[model samples]
Target: MIEMIEIAPKVLGLRINGKINEEDMEKMLSVCKAKMKDEERIAVYVEVEEIGGISFNALIEDLKFALPNLKRFSKKAVVSDIKWHEPLIKVGDKLFPSIEVRHYNQDQRAEALKWVQE
Candidate 1:
């Protein structure tokens, strides 16, 4: 499951708890795109509760959405306790250089939000 919200004027918050299928991903992207219609850049705070994989179609859809929004994000904070999340996030940093990606442990949710707000 994917829960997405605009925590601030231009800050997007997301919580992923289960497998993210293509339909959910498409909806998430649509919501975000609509929310960001007038804004050139945004900040994101994501918290991962469980280890979930994305569908191939979801990945393709995500890239389609991301391609045009290359420089749309200013900062992104990911909160996850999973060990592999760090390396995965690092890879994301390489894929989307527009945003600065940082990973914090689940215990550091407050800090992560604070960082994203900055």
Candidate 2:
């Protein structure tokens, strides 16, 4: 399941658990774009309660959504308990030095949100 955990003007927060399908990815992209319209730079906080693989169509949608917004977001904070998730996100930082995406341990979720707001 996916939920909008919080939102503040130009900032958006999301929580996702279990497997993510193409519909979830599409919905998330729609919500994010709709909420962030007219904003030049966006901040996002994503809390992953659990990690599961995405569907083939979801993977395609994810790439489509992310590639366009790679430099549009000022900060992207990913909160998760899984240590392995860090490596996956760090690759984005390497690819896009303009926008840095950080991984926060679940306990540091508040800190992650604060950094995103900054």
Candidate 3:
């Protein structure tokens, strides 16, 4: 399941857990686009917990949505217990120099949120 967490004017905070389907991805994309319409540059905070899996269609949608909107994001904070995600985010930081990407363990969720809002 994927749902919106906090709704700051220029920030998008989400909590994603369990399996993610196309509907979930579509809803997230819709909300993101709507938020982007109001704010030029937004900060994103994502908290992932016990992820079962993600559908291929959702993954494809994510790629399609992310590529074009990369420039619209100022900062992204990902909080997850998944160890591999940290390194992947680091790679993304290197690849997308314009956007600041950071990863935190599940325990540091509050810190992640604070940093993203800053």
Candidate 4:
């Protein structure tokens, strides 16, 4: 399941609990694209409960949207229990200098949301 959380202006929040397919990616990209049109840049907060699977089509769509618009993202906060995510985020922070990526434990969801808005 994927749901949008309205946290702040120009900040997009998403909660992902299950498998993500192409349709989910398309829906999210549509909303994000609309937000980008009005705000130019945006921050993101993602709370991941469990990712059962992701379709290859969804991955491709995400890459298409993310590659060219990397600079359009100011910050990203990921909240999950996955241990590897922290190191991955650190690497992402370096690779995408324009976007600051941070990882937070699932218990720190509130803090992640606050930080993403900041």
Candidate 5:
């Protein structure tokens, strides 16, 4: 499941769990684009609590569409218990230097929010 909330004017709080597929990817992208339409700067707090897994094609499509938006966001905080996500986010940081991607433990949700708000 994927859920999103607008925490601030240009900040979005997103949570993802369970198995993500192509349909979920499409919905997520639509939500993000709609939220960011009039905002020049955005911040995202992405929480991955129990992601069963993601489809390979869906993951690729997500990256293709979302990576460019990272440059438009001021900061992005990814909270996850998944080990592989850290390195993946680090790579994303390199790809979009304008946006800061910080990974946090699942328990550190509040801290992640604070970091992005900073």
Candidate 6:
């Protein structure tokens, strides 16, 4: 499941658990775009504690839609226990100069939030 909430004028909080499908990716893209339309400097806090995995097609679509927006965002924080996600996130950080993706333990959510807010 994907849950998204606007925490601040320029910040969005996201929680994802379970497999992500194309529909979910599309929804997330729409939400992000809508929020970014109002705020140029978007920040995202994503928690993926229960996310089992993401489909290959969904991942591709997500990247296609999100990459451009990442450049417009100020920061992005990804909180995940999954180890394999680190490399992908690193690549994303490299691709998006405006965004910084930091992997944090679930317990370090506060620190992660602070880093992104900085």
Whose lDDT is greatest here? 3
lDDT of each: 0.85, 0.83, 0.89, 0.88, 0.83, 0.81
Task: Give the CA lDDT, 0 to 100, for residue 3 in model 4.
Answer: 82
Model 5 lDDT vs. the true structure? Answer: 0.83
In TM-score terms, candidate 2 sits at 0.90
Highest TM-score model number: 4
lDDT (10s digit) by residue, model 4, range 24-68: 988888888888989989999898888778899999999988999
Report residue 11 deviation for candidate 3 (angstroms). Answer: 1.3
Whole-structure CA lDDT of model 1: 0.85
Candidate 3 segments exceeding 4 Å error: none
Q: How well is each residue in 1-118 modelled by candidate 6, as lDDT tens digits? A: 6777566757778889999888878788888778788986788889896876788888999878766555687788898888888899999888766776788988888898887776
What digit string (tens of lDDT, one per residue) describes model 1 on residues 1-118? 7888667767878889988889879788877787689677888888899857888999899889878886888989999998988998999999877789999998898898988988
After aligning candidate 3 to the native by TM-score, how far in Å is the CA of 1 from where it should be? Answer: 1.9
Candidate 5 colliding pairs = none
Compose the digit string of candidate 2's lDDT tens values, residues 35-94.
668687788889999867788889898888888877777888999998888888989788
RMSD of each: 1.5, 1.4, 1.4, 1.3, 2.2, 2.2
Clashing pairs in 3: none
The TM-scores of all predictions, comma-separated, are 0.89, 0.90, 0.90, 0.92, 0.80, 0.79
lDDT tens per residue, model 3, 1-118: 8988765878888888899999999998888898899999999898888687899999999999999889999999998989988888999899998899999988898798788888
Per-residue lDDT value at 57 in model 2:
89
